[model samples]
Target: MTTVVHEFDWPDRVVIGTVGRPGERTFYLQARAGKRTASIAMEKEQSAVLAEMIDRMLDELVTADDKLSIPAEAPAELLDDAPLDQPVEEEFRTGSMRLGWDPRTAQMVIEAFPVEEEIPGSDDEALDVAAETESEPSEMLVVRIPVGTARAFAERARRVVASGRPTCSDCGMPMDEGHECAPEADA
Candidate 1:
C-alpha cells in the first residue's frame, strides 16, 4: 500500500482539545486548513511531548531566522475553547510522533505514524534495513503549524495536562478524592 501523507500547511487554526470529563477525557489534536480539518486521537503523554518539542523547535527557529514574526510569549490560556469538530473521525492512533523544521519552506512539520504491531515469532535479524525503509506506513498525518500557532498549542497542552488529578506535594504521587499518604514512620 502506498503511504498517503495528509499535509496541512498554513492552517487557519491548530489546537489541542479533549472530550469527556477531566478524569475520563480523550485528547485530540486538530488542524484546520481551508475547508478540510483532520483530528487524531492521541495519548496525554503524546500531547505533552509534542508540545514540549514544538516549544524547543520554535526557539531554534527564532535564533536561526531573525526576521520570523513569532512572538515570544504564549497566551496565558487557550485562545480557542471549542470542542473537537463534529463527526470527529480519528485519522489514526499515533504511535510514534515526530517534529521537524523545514528551512527551505520555513514551516514546522508534525508527523504522526500509525502504531506497528510486531507479528508473533518474527525474527528481527531477518528484517533488512532496505525492506523496512521501502515499506509504506499504513497512514501518516502531517501538519505544518506556524511558530506562533505552535506556541499556543504548547501552552494550552501544558495547561490541559496540569489540569489533571492533583499531585501530592511531598511524594508527588497523584492524589485521589480521599487520598491520604501514609504518615512517615518514626525515622
Candidate 2:
C-alpha cells in the first residue's frame, strides 16, 4: 500500500487545539498551508509532552551554541492566539511521533505516524508483522517550521494543554462539576 505523507514545509500555521468541554475535549494537531490542511487526533498527555520536549530541546540548543540565533522565548510577532481553522477534520489518530532539528535549514521537524492496530497472534507473529510494517507507515504527517515559529508553536501547545479541566489540590486529579477528592491515608 502507498503511504500518504501530509508534509508542510514552512507552513503558514500549525498548532495543537481541542474541541468540546475541558474534561471531555479532543486534542488535535493541525497543520495548514494555503488551502490545504491536515488534522490528527492526539492524547492530551502527548500534546503536553511534545511541548515540553520541544522547549527542552530548544533550551539545550541555546546553551550548546551561544552564537546560534535561538531565542529564549517566542517572539511577539510569532505568537499565535487564534482559534484553530474551520472544518477541523481528523485525518488520523497519532500513534508515535518523532521530533528533530534540521541544522541546515534551522527548522524543527515533527513527524507523526498513525496508530498501528495490534494483530492478534503469537509473539513471533507480532514480530513478523512489525518487520513487515517497519519500512512503510500507512500515513504520516510531516511538519517543518523555523525556530521562531517552533517556539511559538510550543508556547501555544503548552497553553492549550494547561487549559484543560482544573485539577484537585488534594488528589492532583482533574476536577469536574461533580468531582470529589479522595483523602490520602497517613503513612
Candidate 3:
C-alpha cells in the first residue's frame, strides 16, 4: 500500500522536496516552493512517502543554497489545476495502474488514482472517479537548510549527476534549462 499525496505550487521560506526516480511512469519532484521551481506526482508508494518526506524536510528545513522560496499562497494542488495534460480516458482508470515516464527517470502521470469515468464504446460504461485526489498529503515548502550546507550541495550534485555525460535529453523540458520550455513536451 504505497502512500501517495502530492501537489505543490505555493511555498517560500525554503521548500526543496526531492524524489525523481523517472521510471515506470510518474514520481518526479525537485520541489523548491521557496525558489519557485516545482513538480509533483507519485504512486510508487507515494514515491516512498515523498522520499522520506524529502529527507526529513531537507533535514530540518533548507538553508544551504537559500533559494527555495516558492510561496505566494498558491498551494492547494496547483498543477495548473491538475488533469495533467488531459486526454486520459482509459475508462477513467481503476487500480493497479502502470505507465511510467523516463525524462531521465520519471514523473509523468500527474493525476491518476482510483479515478474512473470512461465513456468509450461502452463496456459497462465504467465509472468510479468518486474522488481520489492524488491520494492526499500535499502541503510542501519547508526550507530550513544547513545540514552541512545541504550535504555540501548534495555532494556536489551527486558528483555532477553521476557523470554519465550524454547531453541533449530534456525528455519533457520543464524549462529553466536553456529556456526552451519543455511543457511536458507539449503534454
Taking all chains together, each candidate's TM-score versus the true structure is 0.82, 0.91, 0.20
- The candidate that wins on TM-score is 2
- Candidate 2, which segments miss by more than 4 Å at Cα? 120-134, 185-187
Question: Per-residue lDDT of 18-70 in model 1, one digit per residue for the tens?
Answer: 87776687888888888788888889889999988888888877888798866
lDDT of 2 by residue, 110-178 (tens): 999999876676799777977686668889999999989889999999999999888888888998888
> Residue-wise lDDT of candidate 3 within 1-187, one digit each (tens)?
2533333322232221223333324433233443344343434454444334334445433343255432323333321212222222122122333222222321222223443333345434232332243343223322233333233323333332333223445553322335543435453
> What is the full ranking by lDDT, best candidate first?
2, 1, 3
Clashing pairs in 1: none
Q: Give the TM-score of candidate 2.
A: 0.91
Residue 164 displacement in candidate 3 (angstroms): 0.7
Best of the two (2, 3) by lDDT = 2
Candidate lDDT (C-alpha), each: 0.78, 0.91, 0.32
1 or 2, greater by TM-score: 2
